[model samples]
Target: MIAGEFYKWTDKKGTVHFTDNYLSIPHEYRHQIKIQKMEETSEKKMEGIAAELLIKKSVNEERKAISDGEKAFNEKCTKCHSLSGKNQDDSATQLVGLLYSDKFKESTLPVSEDSVKRIIKEGGGEDMPSFPEMTDKELNELMRYLIPYLKKK
Candidate 1:
């Protein structure tokens, strides 16, 4: 039926009726009738729900990855690279400043993801112990934690 062309009317005995034919509705009650649009189809509604679920799942996964990265950094690097700048012993470096320093940029060590992965696995120097035992996945997580600090000024 064409939208806005349908009619609803109540009879004298209080029974209600709906029809697409304008003639079926009595003249007195015709002014009271109003057409209503159809609601969305189930398929359309389900598609919207599915899209929303996918977006939520992606966001949740990102949050989990970040949390895991922070945990890995704390477990692996905090011993040799102090998170706080103060009170670092001779054996350890203050990591926060080092990440943004020109010296760090000039070093032979590469800072890109794959290069960082190699360095983490092989160790940067004699002063830094090799973490050959760390899996590629764990190294990735640690790198995620450190990459923000390594950004150029």
Candidate 2:
């Protein structure tokens, strides 16, 4: 891909919206990006506010999902891919945290029990390993545990 300038506009709420295609932005914000280069401080302030708001939103939504994912990870994945002091860098344990991120919520990255199970039992990536012995039922249980986080976004 070639590197190029991206047009970004700050909303009234200070959210920094970005787009490569001009049609992605609303008319209200279209002028903001065009005018923003005139002042840099305001841009920084807007980005900071946007970041703060993003963090706050993420922290607020996982009250129950986080608890459930942790419980499931502790109960199941912990059996082998331990999250103990000795296995601090464990792969399975580490994956639990991102099992249901909004980043993977779409069809492009569907986070379901079956999806996780397939990866677990048929692991193939550079850092992945197969848990071929695991049954479909077990995978479903794991997905059940992670359902909350999957639904978060």
Highest lDDT: which candidate? 1
List runs of model 1 lying over 4 Å from the truth: 1-45, 85-92, 97-100
**28-106, model 2: which lDDT tens digit per residue?**
7776665333245366765764576476566655455455546756764555554232432344344434545433454
- Clashing pairs in model 1, backbone N/Cα/C closer than 3 A: none
- Give stretches of model 2 more than 4 Å off: 1-72, 75-112
Candidate 2's clash total is: 0
Error of 2 at 13 (Å): 49
- Report lDDT per candidate: 0.65, 0.56
Candidate 2, residue 36: lDDT: 33
lDDT of 1 by residue, 20-111 (tens): 56765688887777663334335574455456547756886777777898997787777777665464334346555455565557888664
> Among all windows of ten consecutive residues in candidate 1, which has the lowest summed lDDT?
36-45
Model 2 TM-score, 2 decimals: 0.33
Q: Residue 33 CA error for candidate 1 (Å)?
A: 34
